[model samples]
Target chain A: MITREEINNIALLSKLFVAENEMESFRTDMEQMMQFAQCVADADTANINTDDTASSSPMRQDKIGTSLTVQEALANTDASCDGYFVVKKNG
Target chain B: MGRIEQIHSLLCKKDISCRELTEEYLNAIQRDNPELFAYVTVTAQEALTAADKIDRQIAQGGDIGMLSGVPMSIKDNISTRGIRTTCCSKMLADYTPVYDASVWSKLKNSGAVLLGKANMDEFAMGSTGENSCFGASSNPYNTALVSGGSSGGSAVSVSANLAVYSLGTDTGGSVRQPASFCGVVGLKPTYGAVSRYGLVAFASSLDQIGPMASTVEDVSLVFDSIAGGDVLDSTCNRDYKPDTYKTLKDDIKGRTVGIIRQFADNNSISPEVKSSMNEAVKTFEDLGAKVIMVDIPEILRSVPVYCVISCAEASSNLARFDGIRYGYRAQGDFMSIHQLICKSRSEGFGKEVKRRIMMGTNVLSSDKCSFYYDKARALRQALSNEFSRAFSQCDVIIAPTAPTPAFVKNRVVADPTVLYMEDMCTVCTNLASLPAVSLPCGYSAQGLPIGMQIIGDKFSESLILNMAYKFQQATDFMRTSDWGVKL
Candidate 1:
């Protein structure tokens, strides 16, 4: 079972803020998921070589061509400066 | 002839104008979408415009493609320029891409009419399609049951005949499970066989865009149009020859099929699904194919392995949705950009997405990295090797797509682990980077559809399609379903 402190630490690393009301349920759900994932720890992986070449697509030519226009790129942003994305500043 | 070919012939002979066909689908969406919730946005005007172009081409005696003016739905995760491509998540509720996904572009260039964007689980995270902020899409067969998701809406649209066919992405069993529940044909091509340039990433290594249709022939047509390489997606297979549609009618005599002994075990699968597997085996035997039982012990651990790898990759893939650039941003004052990002994510993502992201972060954390994440990768490799050995004995592996048919909605929501177990049979193919297709083999006692999965070796889409085509021909599961929406 995972502790609440560890869940908070995970939220901090993941940049997700769990609400006060949902924290307990969230913690419980995470613990259950972790318990389910514990099967990986028990699996026998001795001498198992990870196949790096199992599935791969060919690389394209390293050449620049058409790209997203500045306006098109910033079309969905909430705020933008002159050809740059804008965000809140730290106090 | 198949529905797609029939429609093509109708258009070629000037029997039915593209405008009429498009209008028929639009009318169906208008009539049925209110109850089904299969579509998030309807592109009625754009579809009519495209249909007009096809009619003009036909008037000039110019040749049109096989899918020209065919009405279809695209799962919302695949980007369409100027069309909202929300993964049914609030984070990207308003995020419309500046360009189209590779698959969308290919279908568009083929003159396929766009009906609308189908709703899906937020970030393709959930199994029952209930995780969508847009509200869960109901099964066409039974409104009380789930449309097995993350491609639930796509499956429903095809099942209900709102569109002739639709495109869906399968990470684990998103396409196959829903396709099974809805009694449609869903194909998940081998990894790298289709480009993933504009698909919103869930798990980079496991995601593949596939087609859902009422018939294997239509699925083949859609797959042929979309499969191949794209310079934008270096992971797409450039050498893949999607020539399955041409030889889809080939006989399956003298073929060897391996049935996983574990799937038929009464403890794991329901009686209905087990009987369906038996009927499917008998059908193969009747078709002059040899059937043998094969065992892969590693497959039993696929769900846990999938959870670790997919969640870990999802945590990294979804980290891009900060409040800064695009998507839904929380409204409040915050001390730092980090706080802003946290707040945005907290408010933007649904419960399932958050849970997966947090679990992913936990497994990938420094303390648990080697013990959990690395071990899962090694086990995945082992599972892949086991599948390779199994394929050496048989051309394809047969199993139940899910342990049972679609369960009642919200029954398994309280326990996320139970829902995760539903992917047990389907995720093994994703872990092995193999192609698999799910077609309606039989129906449950209560009239719900049951899916039989046919999994092939890597890049063996043609073989799998041929097998599914033969099975479909021998069965009436696709044609016998009476739940389709009448337009």
Candidate 2:
């Protein structure tokens, strides 16, 4: 069963700040969602292969068709220094 | 009336001018769409200009394209030249593509009028249109109910008569499920059948641009126009050219269709969806085609495998949304570039998109890759093999497009898993990269519309369309414009 705390944790992981007032409603809704998902989870895949025999790398070729200048790339960024995008340090 | 036939008759007789048709549609959009949110952007000025050109060409007796003068809408995820291609995300709300997607260019060259860009789930990540930052797109049949999505706007616009047809990308049933809910014809062509040059990637390997329309013939007509090889989409092979969809009307006296065994719990599929599938079986049998039960066990595992693979691909595809490009950029007094990337994405993307991206990132992580992503890929290949074997037994498969009718706006369960389950019936088609179409088959006990999915072998759309057309002709389901009730 989905719980208020579980909803809060999922919200945090998703980077959304759900209001405390909405937690109970979210929990209730998530419970129904879990039930529906359980339906999909019930499909039997026992005999099917579940290992990687296929290529895991990108299929994109190395040939260069288009290029964006560093200046252009960094233009829309909120923080930039010396043609590189800058970001805050996460703990 | 048959949609394509009607358009062709109008053009042949010169009874209704192309410009007049374009103007009428634009007027309809203006009249009905304020509350519908069907179209995120209606290019009235642009469409009229295109229509005038087509009219001039017809007058000159030039070899006009098949879809000449037909007005259509495109999902926001597909880029249109010089227009805002936001994919209903705040991140790219202000961004306009400098170049057009190949499919859009093909339609433009064919003299089709661009009605506008329809709304969708943010970055094509959600099952319901509610995930859009702009707003939820309401079902034209019932404003209180959802239109179904991530191609919600495209489906609703076609259902509401806002356009002749619309284009939607299906990655794990984004297009078909919405089309089913909206009670329109939605096709997810065989993988590589259509170029993905301009479609914003949700899951690149699985994404395909296809047609959604009021009828099966119209869907085929649009599909014929935009399909075929494009140099821009490397995955698409120009070598294979399937027969024209019009040819599907020929006799299929000896053809066989398959019915997938009930794999999930009875509760997984609502009574409405099951009844619709059963009715569809009867209709097929009546059409002189043999119906057989085929069990290719791989489908049972397709859902979780699809979830893992789709999320992994999504995480990689969405990494481009870091605020360094032309999209929404959040501002703060003291922030580093890294802070900006996380902050902009966190703030710009809607809740559903972030959840998928996080799930994707976690699945693709080095430590978890083997357990989730690798296993998913293996299962995908197995599913492909299963489909091939199933095809040996029967020419096609029949299933419900979705498990239930359209839910009311904000009525969806908030759990991500629940939202993911919406694609269960539709995802297997994508998993095998097979051609599938969803057509209205029956209605819920409350009278909400239901859709049946017809799946065919790779590049076998003609057969699928034929089956859908036969059913559409045999039933009253496709005749009416009115559905009248909301969930």
Candidate 3:
């Protein structure tokens, strides 16, 4: 069973708010998916070593490539300050 | 010939102008899309513009490429320069990408006409297309039923002849499931075989942009057109590509076909799907390929492993959508920037998207259960090894694309666990990062399409497509939808 506090904590970490009424159902769904996930632990992974087996992606060329300009990047937003993205700092 | 070739020949011969073909498709979409909802944004002017360009080139007697003048739709999750790419979520509902995804750019360069952006489940998170903020795409076979998703619209467009073919991104069964549901051929290429440069990220490791169409040949044509080395996507392998379309019709007589005996015999598989698999086995045997059972005891665990890992990656990938940048931004009072970001996401995303985000964050959180993600990753390796071992015995493995046929609307809602089970048969390929294709093997009693997938080892697209081609040749299963358009 998942406690409400755990749900609230993760939601905080996720930077999203769970409404007071929606918390129970959210916790329930998380609990059920988590329960389903427990099956992975039942598999005996003794033969596998997880620490040393990181998969590496190939590197692209280090040369500069064409990318979105400051204007193009800032075109879709509601807040901007002379080509830079903007946000409120404090109350 | 594939749809791409058929359209190419018509243009090459001047038998039909590109504008006429483009008009027919646009008209068909206008007539049918009200019921099917396959396309959310149709690029009519762009398609006509491309078509007119092709006509002028033809008038000048200039040679055209294979995909030139072919009308096609792209999943909205793929970024299109100056076109809205919603991923069917309110968060990016009005978001227009400033750059084209690599796949779309490749198609554009090849002169493929853009029909529109296809609808899909929000952020490619849901199993059913019903999760779309716009609306679910209805199955062309029966409008009351769902077009399986998050690539539902891609499948529906091809099935209903809204477009000759469409691009859909598959992370976990998003392409194949919808293809299976809509009675079209869909291929989820090897993970790195196709570039993921402009696809809106769902789960980076599992996400791959693939093609869907009414025939295996068309699927191959679209796959070949879009697949190659991309400097933008490092994960895309430069040397892994083989000319799959050239070898698409190659002989598979002596090749081995593998089947999971347990799944074939399991009660979870509906009677119709089982019958179809049985017939598929006989067909392959008749073609002189040996059929055998391959064992991988971890087959059932693929879904859960996929869930844990995909959600975790999605959480990280989607963190870029903070109210700061180019997606939906919230308005109103807030104390801090952090609060503003939270409010934007909470308001912008739908229920299913929020659920997935929260679920992903929980798995990655500092809680004791964060270990679940690690174990899922380890088990993922184990599963891949098991599949590799299975591959050593057989050239290709066959499995039902879904346990049953497409779900009637609301039938799969309410229980998230039940919805996840719909992906059980399809998630294994994503977990292992292998290539798989879902083609129609048969239909349910109600005439709903049933799909069976042919999975190959990493980068074995040619072998699987050849086998699928051979199977399609010998059988009269729902090879292509016969809804008014033929290539």
Model 3: per-residue lDDT, tens digit, B359-403?
A: 788887766453678788888888788899999999999999989
DockQ of 2: 0.24
* Model 1 residue A1 lDDT score: 69
Off by over 4 Å in 2: A1-91, B263-265, B412-414, B482-487
Give stretches of model 3 more than 4 Å off: A51-53, B479-487
Instruction: Report per-candidate DockQ.
Output: 0.80, 0.24, 0.72
Q: Estimate each model's TM-score.
A: 0.98, 0.87, 0.97
lDDT of 2 by residue, A25-46 (tens): 5566545433433433444446
Q: Candidate 2 chain B, which ten residues in sequence have the lowest lDDT sum?
A: B478-487
Clashes of each: 0, 8, 0
User: How many backbone overlaps does candidate 2 show?
Assistant: 8
Q: Judged by TM-score, which candidate is best?
A: 1
Query: How high a TM-score does candidate 1 get?
Result: 0.98
Show the colliding residue pairs in model 3: none
User: Candidate 1 residues B1-487, lDDT tens each?
Assistant: 6678889998999998999989888988898888889999898888999999999999999999899988899999999998899999989988989999989999999999999999899999988988899899999888899999999999999999898999999999999999998899999999989999999999998999999999999999899889997878887877887899988989899999999976766377888898999999999999999999888888888999999999999999999999788988988888889988999999999988998989899999998998899999999888888888999899999999999999888784566888898898899999989999999999998989999999999999999999999999998897533444343
Best by lDDT: 1
Writing each residue's lDDT as its tens digit, candidate 1 over A1-91 gives 6777887899999999877888899988988888888889776667888767354546556887888889998999888999998888877
